[model samples]
Target chain A: MTKTSTKPAPIRRDWIAKSLAGTLLGFTLAMGCSGLLILATAGLSPGTRAQFAMWLVTPIWLGVLSGCFFFSSGLRAWLWLGGANLLVFATLLLARPA
Target chain B: MRSDYIRIYKTVHTWTGILTGMALFIAFYAGALTVFKEPLARWAAAPVAALEVPLAETPALIAKTLAAHPGAAKGFQLNLKPTEDEPARLSWVEREEGQDDHDTLSGHHYSATLDAEGNALVSESQPSQLAEFIDILHRVVGLPFDTDPNRWLMGVVAALYALALVSGVIVLLPTLVKDFFALRLGKNLKRMWLDAHNVVGIISLPFHIVMAITAVVFAYHDGLYALQDKFLHNGRLANAFNQQRPAAKPAPRDPADMLPPVTLLERAQALSPGFEPSSLQYVNLAGPRAMVRVWGTDPAALAPRAMGGFVALDPWSGKVLSRDFLPGTQDAANTTLSSFFALHFATFGGTPVRWMYFLLALAGAWLFYSGNLLWIESRRKKQRQGEALPGQRLDTRLLASATVGVCIGCIAGISLTIAAAKWLHGHVADLNAWHWYVYYGVFFASLAWAFWRGAGRAVVPLLWLAALSTCSIPLTTLLAWAVPGLGMWANTSLAALGVDATALAGGFALMWAARATARRVRLGAEDSVWSARKILPSCQGLS
Candidate 1:
């Protein structure tokens, strides 16, 4: 096995901030995504749309939460996910049935 | 991935996995048994004289039963093939007042049959809840009750479990190819355990993913539906699943006019040739919106739910009201959704799939157990050759004790309670409450014993206890048959026999574990917490 550096890396974890951002922002992002899908599938039956909307949220929420750690910093994670949530929810609001 | 990202993910995997390992162990172990829940229920059920109400007589039976007990008009099930679990031709459960919708156990069970004189013989029944008790453990991670709080806790654990899976995959990605399927068993036990853990985790990644995702969905589907109702459906999502018919002055309908159970079965079978009808669930039979759900299995297709799929029918005209959940007849979107349930519940591809799930679930339980051992081993303190033996770290010792206590205690507790189902039937006033008492009693006692004796000292004895308790399941059956004086009874059905067979094998496995653990404790390295033998400096030279 090759020897590697034992010193600490030069990156910040920001665990608490990252977790908070991931949890709160990730949820909104998931809800927004599901809302968009529900609006897009308005032509389908209500039961089908409801099923899709309900089931699709968890995977998306978890995906965002998992990906949150990959962000360079917690602030960036919050900013990007917050922006995505805003855009998606705006589309949902605009396209939703009156 | 960057090396620092890999390092961060490794930390994530370790913390998430350690936090949920024992709870997930109990969940997976109980879940493995729950895959054969019907057989377990059958094994625990007291044998009764079979009620031979034929298919042709079900209509008359239903009418007479409804006439005698009008409350049953809300819902009643006509069992098509009466097994040891449901020996009666007709049975129904009435939920207690103010009971939660998800609570399946707190209900008044009643079964009806036609006597020799052709009259409805309705009797209140207390079917054994051993299987449902185990199922509750599986659903809520060893919690006694299936309440919202317990389910929400389970949801949190499942979320962490999913995170663990993803982070674990990422951590392994660095050496994914080099260590793929490598099981090097040698002096380095940590490496061996790690290899074993990786093999199971990687090979069964898809299975674990399905379990984690479905578990989260199952726990939080109600809240998800509420959110959807508010945002997506304009607060009307609940109305979608329930068929809406314009009410033209609601009136009570006669149960006598409803179509027979056989006709509903025939219609369901005609719709899907592979669908084998198990029961006819008559919902709201006296109401204008009466419907019968033909519940059954389709071996060739995915089931939408654990009790298999159903096709709602208008009982009056035998018209198919809804085919959305019908297994073989689902649309593409429905099939995709049903695949989740079917994959998690092992409801498709018949008996072979169920067996495969049972083994995979057991393997999953082992994966959690081995993960804990790996954590403990990685933290083991090594003693130098010339230096005096150093004390192990407090955290590792405590964690070792807890891991053994919770996991082994759960195994012994479930097995002993299963045996008690036969032993304590008529002797107890409320057998169901006694089931809880026995399980918690053994579980807490085992935990206490583990702490008092230390994990190394307690592990072998606990393994013996688990083995003896599991062996008692089959032994109870043997005594029931061989010794007629015993009040316990045994069913000769294949399902019940299968339960006995499986328990016997599990018992031997636990015995082997005890022997292996004893060997490790006595002969393994002295520095490890698993070692119980004390080496004195003076005696080392004398020996």
Candidate 2:
């Protein structure tokens, strides 16, 4: 009854792929999310907002990475996460004071 | 949600727990006790030396200490109304300037106390680091081939731990509200364990999440702080990784200009009404940035950072530089974040909350242990069609031995070493070094014994050892008092008394566990390795 869903073949391959995606893509998403939070609270005191931004960094990163497991396949998880990460990163790039 | 995803997540959860369960158990258990580090340190202190000074007397002590050890004039912390365990202690780090290498040689920590004659008397006695050593085991586990600092490996573990939490929640969500709380405690031991595990786990989900996030930050906060300095302060990310957070440093103050310790406490108290001063941190005493930060506990606040409140005072002018984190002074966002830290470290709701965290931590440890046992039970392979083999599979035996060795051994090692703190105090050359020797000695011995005698034979004896070592903490304390002239406050100070009483209770509990396990091994399950009766007769094919 217990040995049902987790087949052995694809697991050896996909786990590594999923881990890499979580590290790279999840970090990108986390960085973007934190930046966006800082920008959103740009009106607050700089120190306060910055501390708040610092506080959000870990949860957002871990959250994004953990959310990756819900996807049907490792490749799909990678693709969707990568796309969202890019969208956020690009938005931050354009919105920056450069 | 698809059923396949549940299976996948269950796989994820199981593997993650298997990989990280042992370390997390150590961390939670030790972390629970770390909250009471002050009390333990106090209990370990020699009765004669456990004296505290009032704030009014600190200025004199500081003056005499400065006059005696000129190095401390540069910087030192004048500890004030600290916890009962620590009293009016002053400390400083010895910085060796002008080393050949770029990094300043920073070691030689000095903690001094003033004598009755106002002479600067530095304490040469060593602390057992009993609490700290456990904390290190929690934080680092000192696992092989991980990382040099071990904190980075801890961060990676924290990340995996976070993933485990997420997956566990999802996997249990479907029937979480229905059967998660149902305790079917009849014949099905596995069912009972599963119910208890899920119930405790889900109840503490928020606490676990806070630990995961804060652990990640603590593991790599310096780098993260540097990252912020890079991104926000018109700095480069390339330079950030190599640099520390920039300090708002100014020149140090002259010796004559340094303010009195009581004045700093008064200023802190004035800034935050009803603030009970804990300690005073004097920084850059020889430079322009010479400021004394008075830390305290507010009667009305629960901010994290453990100390609860802070007020920085200028050494020269004795003027308040910045004041926040007190009961009335904290800004909203900072206050909110501090509460999260408070939750992470169990700093809220005082002693009651601490006791709750302590129970929860032990429960958390049990969850992991029972999970391992369940795995071993489930994976026992069959020798014939529909017939079970009495001997456990190789994998089960290996895991069983490791689980008992690592978990029970850790319990024994920490307990005995802590118990040794009193006897080894003045007799030992280095009291702190003896702590390491005692812990490693017992730890490896237990491990070797477990692997040598096999799980069924070793469990009872190892547990008895644990019970003996743990109970000895209180026994030693009471024993000292039994000698007429050797009375120390063995029965006073509820916190100190509580520690000993709790240890004694834990010892009794372990004894009960040992007896129960022995019973289980002797009479239950005819084919199981847990039954020594079965294992003894079926030993021909086994190693």
Candidate 3:
């Protein structure tokens, strides 16, 4: 009698990895849209623009914030990105015209 | 600590949803419609003259009325110049305190317009009936007979809405990332419902939060007034509260002997630079106290709340006394408030925003209904298998009834009341009373019907009724046009063709729902009644 091998299906690592990647992309898009809105509406000065640029990329600093919710091997990278973004927004809010 | 917090929030969300879901549904739905209040008003007052009267006309009209009936000129308001599709309406209220006889007229109230000779024109083109009714629905849920309890009750409901929103977010947090775009269809009712509820909730998260917060703010404005009195006013609650209160007694002003209305307008405009006059108010006509107050909008402003400015002018001297322009701080606050309104009304950026909000609002309404379905689907098998305790079955039924009653009830009530407005327009003794009668009458009738007919059967019929009522918007217009006094072609007509067009689009949607429901019923679906059919089959398979 031939024994039919019963093994657990693979974890579909690619799909999970893609989902994580997609989430990061979505986060980026959302941040980009928010930045565009600020530029279009906030009437920022040249100095303010430089400050905002630094803040815009700060989402990467809060890498821990993203991994706190989801379980992924690429969590550390997301955390770093998120941590950076938080730092950027904080700086922008604190920025004053010189 | 985190887990415990999440649990507490979950409980809060569930209880809040249970408590305020019905009221919030009505408020949000009615409010969404109210964003187009002007358009609705125009629709209600169809066939009116597309008059673009000068802002100066209001004071002139007020002067004419005061001259004609001097005793009736206690306090008057300029109805403002109507847009290209509306007629300017002028109205004044006269109050007589301490009248001896019960039958004695408290005060004379008169509204009139100017003729080609600038004489008083007596025509009854009151505010739009439908718009007023919708406003009432939005404000008080049409419960005039029980105002005190209703306000308090609605206030509680608003509080509960905040709780629900917070809890809903908490519940969503765990799966938000994995299921951000996950809309799984087919046979697992619980999963399907969860997906629907989550998708809608998350997609419209910003809108839902705004609605909840604003609803609480609006419904509990009385509380805010109290707070302002307590904290900001240094214990002078009454005085603080009264500051924002609209001027009640129209101070009798001595009308100037003779003054050029255009001059007053020009002076008022000059006082408020870059502001276009929206309305002009003349007080105490023919008396020395006669004054022209010009209300205008600032064009360069981003916020509509801060956009309005006021200039009060002395008709005789054309001297501007008060110029209330939006201050910087006030403008910022007003801008925030205005954004909230813009978000709520979908009028911030104009047409595209309005359409987006409309679709999202409808989706929100769907989310509320589907959330209840998810709860039921999760619990249904237990009841069917006899595994649920005795009270569980009753609980299930009650929830079912409530879900059906509130959702379908609101829809049918709004539709019937709107339709009835046309039927009862000129015949009713009091237009306002008739509006209330129709609204409450339909509401009660719907509640009773929901209870009598099982939720399953009631769903399709109520959907059809709602669809039919929405569909009737265009038909009502056509009927108005066909009827001699009610047609839209007349320059003085109050209804707008845009409203009719909206109704036609709404009708198509209703037809689509009816078809979907019929298909579900044919498929022998469980819980096909209160749940939307498009997602039902997939939900069933999941179960």
Candidate 4:
């Protein structure tokens, strides 16, 4: 990691689009993550599992939202988050209780 | 973090804060007052004649009261220690038909006691809703009602607030170590404001984080439960919580056969020596699953709910049914879960913790207020030494007016309404409705006055108004004692007197603020929106 004189590329701030991406996609991602949690904790009592699932959504959603700006562009954010959402939801569907 | 990431986070923090600052200001301010909701209710409750029913006689009273008012069989309370707010031995509330379950203020309250002849003396009562109303304002960000839509709006604000907090921390990360404790007080006003904001924000970061997360959960818990039911519990979430189901065709039980109040209290205290029983709530007393919840607080452990934890028991058999919510008796998992609620409600550390939360909440409110001030100050168009000052931006002026209006308006409105609880009790036909009117009237009038007169001219008078309104709280108590013919009553309890003392301090603080703000408007920067020398274009020649 040698120091260089060249300036780093300017980050594009498409705030509105990125905000929409974070809000809409971040929620689905939270649901998917919590869904996976529900599947993993299926052996726990129904009440406990339900409590865990319900309380888990806000923190996950906020985490994704807070990290969304790290992506260089809104489209990149949407793409990466959309891909992660698909993977998690697919895993959740396959592993859900019968 | 890269400079660009920091810059991005700064923007995120700014936008999120500007969007939710005013609403959060109201929430935190009202929430500070709500920490003492019980005391406020006690102070506002009209003194009633003593109706002390003996503990041994409660069985007969319950039997007769149930015979006369079968509606209370579904749920009712036996007040073990009746305060001014709950003056009778037996009390219950019946919700109006089709009323929302969350709307506690609109319920029909009833209380019962054994008469001299052993007959149940039942009466309808209207408890003062001043405390409940402020709690509602805190919950729904100053909304008049706690409806689904309002709660969802609160959820959005809470979510944005969470984002603001995180991004604010990220933005301050570069200077975190250097400026952590800096409170540069001299001429650089922006530096001073930033330092103050950072001090409060960073010191209370964990508190704000918990509040933000818990507020979002509270706002959307019903919907969250629905999601959990759909996904995790196969629509049996409620059934899972209630392990025992009442028999569909079970025979009704006799209320008189239940264990006496003394036995119930003894049973509860046996489980935990520190548990102080305040009331016994009987749910489904006539049905097969008749249970009595011994509700109280334990100073040593965290309460699982705002009203404190309870031990549910079978009234007839004196068998403990559930100790999940019993504070000191909870298991590891239950204690861990209850800690969230306890931390949010300040129910773990007793009165000292409550006072700490009250002061922290007020500081949180000041954080928002100073954030807005920093915004306006940053946008100020400084005048050249030899030239006339450039006009401040329209957006900044408008924001200045709005900030003063909404923030000071809430302060003044809440203070005046609290005073109204004592003054307008019997004078108004519906005192609860008058609380709403008085609050919104002051709030909107202050807003209109600020926008009309501009922030500089309106701020001083509004602060004075806030001061006087808050001072009226103690003044009302004084008048009630001094002038007995004025139809006002006062409670001498420490809880009630504490309200007067706190309001007296708050009123004088507002006076000092008014004086300081006046000085700033007259002699501070003339190139700012808070300057008295700057006249609006429309009123340029009036003076």
Candidate 5:
């Protein structure tokens, strides 16, 4: 890292696209996780489980949303977050009560 | 490859901040005031009763209330110590056939008690929604949408805010240690501004983070609850996340021998030492199965909740029904979760914490504002050697005007509306309506005024207006006191007077801001967007 000469990062539009993907799509991914939490916390009391579900929602979503910028290419960010979002939503829908 | 990641995060940080800064400014500013919502409510409430109805006479009053409004017999609460505006009030919501309890607007809020002539005096008046309106502005930044009250929109803004926070940290990581506390106050205006912004931000990082996360959770709570119900509860998702209550169902009891409100409060103190009770909530006032819930604060409990404990009692039996989540009695998890909300609302540490949050929230607002100014300043075009014309960009001009318009407008709006509370009562069918009108009218008018005169020159007038509006709060209170016929001197508690004093202080602050802005416009850098003299050419765009 020391060998690499540091230069000011160039402002670009592609970063904006990645941020949008991370925010909108990453939220869906977090919702998927929130949905998935239901299966894991089945044994806990209704109160405890609900608390965990609520407490987990924001940080998890924000984490992935912020993480979205890690992908160098906007296309990769799209494919990665988009795929995860699709998978999560599908699982949530399938898990819906009959 | 590494640089690309940095570049990507930098872009995310900049654009997200620029997009959401204004909204966050409004939210933080309004939210800071909302921390003292109880006092504000007290200050704004119009006087209904001259004296507080004694606790001993409450049961009789309840009987009286039910005799007149028979429907209230089902479920109604007697306010133990109602605010100054409503002394000894009893109220219940009139719900449609199958309306949910959590929904606010679905039911008619009905309150009744005996008037001066011993007759049932009932008011079907709209409950004050002024503080809630400010809260909405804080949450959503006044974004437009179809839903009358939409939290999802606020949730989105919270998400964006969270992203900005993270990306900002990442962008700052490079020079973090060296420039962390530096406040070089030399010729570099941007440096000084940046230093102020960064220092304030970094110092209050934890507060901002907690608020951001909690806000997102609150805004999207319904969706999260629904998700929990769908996946976790397998469809039986009622009252899962309402960890706020001690118990959903109170023990059954006979109404004939119900314990008095004082006795219940005493029992609560006996049950949990160091717990100070605030209010008692009664259910089933005129039935055999009456229950009472007492709310109190525990100073020892962590900073996350107000009224840290509760004691549910069977009215007739004088028996303890439930004591869950009581400050001394609550489990670790409940305490922890409650702490999160308490921290966001500044409930813990009492007045001291609230004061700290108020100042920090103002600093947070300033950070966003100075961020916008820095952006406008950075984009100012460099003048050539031979060119006499001082260069300024169109976008900078527009953004400058808009920034002043919104920030100053909200300040003026809230101040004027608060001032109006002194005069608009009794004469108006609904005082809340008058509050709304004053607020929105001043807010939008300020916006129009800003754009019309241009942001650079408009600052002086707007600031003066803001000062006057804010100063009027205290002035009106004093006037009412001076004029005996106005009847404002009665029941003006220290807390209510404190609101007036704070507003007076705010007005003085605004006057200082006006003076500073006036000076900056007259003598500052001619090429800068803040220089009012340079705004003459904008007439082309207007005419």
Candidate 6:
């Protein structure tokens, strides 16, 4: 006998979502790399430390969004992990001295 | 996404890849080698003492030469110092006013030994043909004719490459997550090939995109000019554009006796604070229309092709006529343009950056070749049984032929040309001519060979030819060394050594590949033997 299978439908890709994701990826990668390079060369200014910290968290956000596109059982775990990392990065960015 | 869109993208990708893969392969591969052009040039002309002449002395030399040979001074450029690989060379082209033609004069190169005050002591030498050949290969696919068609063709290819990249990403979307970092070594041929293709494509996606975009910018510079004229400058484009363009201004027609070289230099220095005079040109000094241009370099301006400032000085009164920095518009645009070219041409930062770019470029070439292989392998089983469509089969064959012909052809042609350079150095009229002859001859020969022999067999032989030709580099060097008065131990010797080293490595690789093929043939024979025995036993048991 054949077994009937049911799974959650793939997320509908709206224009807004796609545009947001693409923009996020581009901005994050550019800013993150740029910030890291600057920081490595000359330590970050106190005024810009928060902004740099926010930029660093962007990769995690991208990882979560990318995971959502697939149908692996471990995807939920990946999303959760990515979310937690983003939160920690954001907290650090906010807490940095001006 | 809609299936229709995916289908359209797939078609676009397929067509583009089929159309432009060959040319792109050659350009990228040769370009990679060009990153080490200086080293290769040095290797070609080895055993010469390293020398550097001061910037100030060059003006004196140029002025002296101009005074002696008025005919040769027209539109001349003096390269002041030699880099590690190249000896300091002076090149001038003379154009007589009444004549429409220009004659070039070279081989007045000088190497410097430092004096007690640490100034240059000058010595003369000839140009290196090997260096010239390598440059030609990088610039125009080593074609004999002008670069107009090649540039236009590359523009179209670059557009197609961009299309391919976009479509490839679309097709790969569904499997990307599962297969990211996946390399299935053991399995069906198609699967293995696909994995390899996917991994390389993803890893080097950024490089491929940059190459495609930069290629378009370089190849379609005319289009950019047209666009700028139409949009940026409005309908009065010509007038607006000309104002920014480098216009030749007529100098005063006074017979100002040649001013002191020191005074002219001082004036130029005063105008441009940081830059030292790199070269000086005196226009029509004897009769009328005399002007001096002192060209200099700005270390900070080395970020890209920002022509820092070339100051033109009135030699007689020490008046600064013009102080020009490469136009701001050009610099802003060239930030992207120059960086892209620098990245592609491997001229960004010094040796480390160039070496990195070289390795990346080679990887990019491999990526293209593997992509073709993956496509072919996907349809191989059907193709073998004649089940594939006629058009599809034709495309597959064509792509295969191109892959073998262009890549291997370039290697073989360039190597042969370099060898010919040494052999025909003094014998050839205009030593540069031998470069064209050898390159074109080998290129066409390879193409013909590819057409005659099927791609399957052509690959092995062509690869071997490439390997052999490369090995000749060392042999050429040895020959140069053995022959007395050949300038073998000179700076040009390094170029020969580099070629030999590269060739030997290539030869060994080809030999190893040939050995692997032999081993595969043996394995196939053994498989047949086992199959025959198994079939006979099965038939007997059934009876």
Deviation from native of the Cα of residue B511 in model 1, angstroms: 1.0
Give the winner by lDDT: 1 or 3. Answer: 1
lDDT tens digits, residues B1-543, model 5?
366666767777777778878878888888778777767777776666443467776666666666677777567666656776445467787788766443443368777766666666677755565555565566567642214255676777778788888887887788889897888886777887778778877778888889889988887777777776775566666665332354455544434356767777788889878777767767665554456777777776643353345677766656776665566666766677777878887777768888898888988888788878777766877545545545578888888888898889989988888877777766788676677788889989998988888887888899999999999988988888789687554237877887888888999999999999899888776667676774454422321
Model 5: TM-score, first chain = 0.75
For model 5, the superposed segments whose C-alpha errors exceed 4 Å read A1-21, A35-44, A78-98, B93-129, B143-149, B239-254, B284-290, B302-309, B317-322, B427-429, B486-491, B534-543
Q: Comparing chain B with the reference, what is the TM-score for each candidate?
A: 0.98, 0.87, 0.79, 0.97, 0.88, 0.73
lDDT of 2 by residue, A1-98 (tens): 14446653343226767767877788768767778886678676655666676777788888877776666568877888888988987887788777
lDDT of 4 by residue, B1-543 (tens): 799999999989988889999999999999999999999999899998857898988989899999999999989999887787888999999877788777777778999998788889999988899999999999999999999899999999999999999999999998999887889999888899999899999999999999999999998989878876786567888887887676586776678888998998999999999998889999988777789999999998899998899999989889998898998988876787788888888898899999999999999999999999988888889877656568889999999999999999999999999999988988889999999999999999999999999999899999999999999999999999999999998899999999999999999999999999999887777778898765555433332
- Give a tens-digit lDDT track for model 6, residues A1-98: 23335764433434344434433543344333433433443343332332233323333333333332232223343444445546644653554344
For residues B332-419, write the lDDT of model 6, one tens digit per residue.
Answer: 4334434544555554444567668777877777777777767665554231332222233565666666767777788788777767
Q: What is candidate 2's lDDT per residue for B483-522, written digit by digit as tens?
A: 6354333635777788898899999999999999988776
Superposed by TM-score, candidate 4 places the C-alpha of residue A88 at a distance from the truth, in angstroms, of 2.1
Docking class of 3: incorrect
Q: In CAPRI terms, where does candidate 6 land?
A: incorrect
| Interface alpha-carbon RMSD, every candidate | 1.0, 4.6, 15.5, 1.3, 2.8, 14.3
Candidate achieving the largest DockQ: 4
- Considering only chain A, what is the TM-score of each predicted structure? 0.83, 0.77, 0.32, 0.87, 0.75, 0.32
Error of 3 at B337 (Å): 5.4
**CA lDDT of each prediction against the hidden true structure:** 0.89, 0.71, 0.56, 0.90, 0.73, 0.55
Instruction: For candidate 2, state the interface root-mean-square deviation in angstroms to 1 decimal.
Output: 4.6
lDDT measured at residue B167 in model 4 versus the true structure, 0 to 100: 96
Give residue B432's error in model 6 in angstroms: 2.4
DockQ of 3: 0.02
